[model samples]
Target: MSAKALIFYGGWEGHEPEACAAIVEEMLQAEGFDVRSEAGVAVLGEADLARFDLIVPMCTQVSIDQVPLERLCTAIEAGTGLAGFHGGMGDTFRDAPAYQFMAGGQWVAHPGDILDYRVEIAQPQHPLMEGIDDFEYRSEQYFLHVDPGNEVLATTTFDGSHAPWIAGTVMPVVWTRRHGRGRVFYSALGHQASEFTNPQMREILRRGLVWASRTTDSRETGT
Candidate 1:
């Protein structure tokens, strides 16, 4: 059977939530996953979630009712994987403690806007970072308030731009965390559709999705 993947997108139209979901769905489909795309958090029902193998929330500033939010949490904890990029996943549901706990981190700030920055690979051996090297990109330097327990995969160096006084700041750009029995992978990139189309970025996302999916063996085990 093909691996099932559901993409929930919407909120803050300026970010092009629909476009982001399209790209993600296409990529996951190409990776042999049966992908489903939807807009808004309301579509995240228990039935919809139970039928899928993974959940990709592309909704920026998602404000879901307690019912759907709880359903999502329960499904994920039962071993459904979750993955996404930028505000769609991280900056969303800022006031929802359950959402925050499931996401493992929150997007607190993006200092210096979209500027040239250097991303350093922190875990080269990780499946998501494998065959990838440190690269430079002219994008927003995401200053995320990350969970201390997360396994960081990549970081970006902040130069003196937004604040002249704070130079040489290092920030986590990619990470993974375990929430209950679920796996969560988050990347601070993809502020726009163009960013997702980058070959390197696309590869990073594709690998991350696969790595975040439910596996027959435990993640802690080499198997």
Candidate 2:
């Protein structure tokens, strides 16, 4: 059987969650995932979440009920993979530090909001970043509250064009970590679905999803 993936999206509309979910769904489908999509928070509580190999949370600025959030976290701890990009994962629930802990970071600010910035590959040797050179990007330059546990893969230097005090700051752009036994991956890229058209952005997300998923053997053994 193909691997399963669930994408739950909805929250602040300015982030274009619907369009963003569609793009990610298509990407995962192409990757051989038996993809399922849901809008709003209902599915998070109701779905048979443990059956899936991966969970992709795409909600932005939304609050998840405590019971559902706990359930979701338990599933991940039991080895269900979790992965997403930009605010969908990085800035998901402002009120839930537990959610941020699972995802590795929270979006604190975008200094310039939408502007030109550079993304530098920090772990060029990692398979996820291989052949992915540092590139210029136009979007939110995310200032995040990052988890030190994360194995950072990419970083960007702040030029302080918009926020002078932060000039020369080195911030993590991509990382992978663990939520118990479950693997978690995130990239502070893809502020909008359109950005996925950029090969580097798309490839990193694709590889990150694949990387974050449980191995077939682990899934079968319930590990």
Candidate 3:
């Protein structure tokens, strides 16, 4: 049977929530996942979440209620993978502490318009990054406030656009972290559908989903 994936998208329409969800759903389906897509958080239920092996949220700048937020966190902690990119994942739920904790990072700022920037692969040996080389793309350079404990998968040197003074600093653009028994993967690359549709970006996301669904227990305990 194909692995199941669920995508919840909504909040600010300007970010193309529905379109983003469609893109993600299509990509996962192409990879043999039984994907489901929804446009809002309202469709999510505790039972609905428990049935999926992966969850992707394409929401932007929105708040989720405490009840559903806790439910989602619980699901991840039980080993359901969570993955997403850009405002859809990082810029979401700015007010909720639990939501922020589950995502492992929060979007704080993006200085310039979509401009040419370089992404440096930090973990070339990691399964998600393996076979991928550093590349440059013309897109928004996200300046994020990331968790200190996250396993950084990719980074970019700050350019002078947002703050010229901080040009030399390396900022994380993609990362993963363990949230209890589950895995979390996030990439700050997709500012729009055009960017997300890039071949490199699609491959990165595909590998990330597979990596996020792997369990250490299954590897060790053979369960």
TM-score each candidate: 0.92, 0.95, 0.92
Model 2, TM vs. native:
0.95
- Model 2 residue 39 CA deviation (Å) reads 0.3
Candidate 3 residue-wise lDDT at 173: 90
Q: Write the per-residue lDDT of candidate 3 for residues 1-223, one digit (tens) a residue.
A: 6788888999888678888788878878777788888777885653567778888988898877878888888889988888899889998889987878888889887778768999999988876787899998778888888889999989999867678887788999989888988889999988887777577787888777766654322224211
- TM-score between model 3 and native: 0.92
lDDT for model 1: 0.81
Order of all candidates by lDDT, from best down to worst? 2, 3, 1
Write one digit per residue (lDDT tens) for candidate 2, span 1-223.
8999999999888788999999989988998899999998789899988988999989898888999999899999998999998888887788998888888889989987999889999988787888889999989999998999899999999999999999999999999888998999899998887897889989999988888787544234211
RMSD of each: 2.1, 2.8, 2.8
Find the candidate with the highest lDDT and give its number. Answer: 2
Residue 212's lDDT within candidate 1 is 74
- 73 in model 3: Cα distance from truth in Å? 0.5
Q: What is the per-residue lDDT of model 1 for residues 9-107, given as tens digits with 9 covering 90 to 100?
A: 888886789988888888888878888787777677535676677899888876778888898898889889988888989978888889888897888
User: 3, model 2: CA deviation in Å?
Assistant: 0.6
TM-score of 1: 0.92
